[model samples]
Target: MATHSSVAHANLTVRQTLLHQLFGDHHGWLFERLRARLGCPSDAADMASETFVQVVALDDPHSIREPRALLTTIAKRLMYASWRRRDLERAYLDALANEPEQFAPSAEQQVMAVEALIEIDRLLDGLSSRARAAFLYSQLDGMTYADIARELGVSAPRVHQYVVQGLRACFEART
Candidate 1:
């Protein structure tokens, strides 16, 4: 029993030793070829190391018929990884470009723009039914609210209400 155990242990050790030798002997050759194909030395070396690590971890290491072909496949996978990284980088850069600048507008311009918007809202709110309808029709539909009331046969107030309710609902939904 001791002899059998000892022989099995020795065989396992030999197999590990053989794998290590094979890895070291082909490491540089594979890396160089990968580097030439990939156009990057550091990337090639990293990928080659990863490929050998994968090869040794497989259940049937000896079943691989062509080491060179296996290495090439690994290289292709690494190239795909590189492309994915680059694509993510491009998307990030594009998003960064569209980000708002971290600065306030000129105080006078900011105040003026806000004041104009407030006045416009106030004017819309203060209009009489027919007047407001006319205003909205002229502003939104390029028609006089008189025309809208004439078409709908309702008071201009009703038309203004419809526009206000629609606008209010849209704003509320957004919020």
Candidate 2:
């Protein structure tokens, strides 16, 4: 009879074997598919690797019946996230471009600011467009509910609700 440690080791070995087999069977196909969609071999390779990483995080990889469909879904989500981050960074840089040289952030500060923005974006992921806009306008632009309502073409109470919803999302994300 196997000891507890031996049984755990055997289970780990089995999971590793399954993961290796899955990677070997699908990595090339996924890489080529991504390459075709992205038009960049390096980006395709990175996306394929990230896709497998997501698979590895699954509780039961063996239960997947349609691997390609799952891989495509995961890759598309990653691609969208990448595009969003790039857009955020570009916008931040454009804003900074208008600042005087004396007030320009250092490279490290810029990186930290971008990372913080990404985290904020993740925290606000499920908010509606108006809710997000209301929250940003209120918090960043110092707009009142009346002003936000006028800008969003909604009632002041509705703007208040949106701002509260945005705050709730951020609070839940923190916890």
Best of the candidates, TM-score? 2
| Candidate 2 lowest-lDDT run of ten | 59-68
Tell me the TM-score of each prediction against the true structure: 0.49, 0.94
Clashing pairs in 2: none
lDDT of 1 by residue, 1-175 (tens): 5798899898778768867877877888899998898888988888898888877887766666777788778768767766655654565446545767564445575556455534444445544555555555656577755678787677777667666664664456459
Please tell me which predicted candidate would have the highest lDDT against the true structure. Answer: 2
Per-model clash counts, in order, read: 2, 0
- Global Cα lDDT for candidate 1: 0.68
Predicted candidate 2 versus true structure: per-residue lDDT over 60-148, tens digit per residue: 88788998899999999999999999999999999999999999999999999999989888888899999999998998889999999
Model 1, residue 57: distance off in Å is 1.8
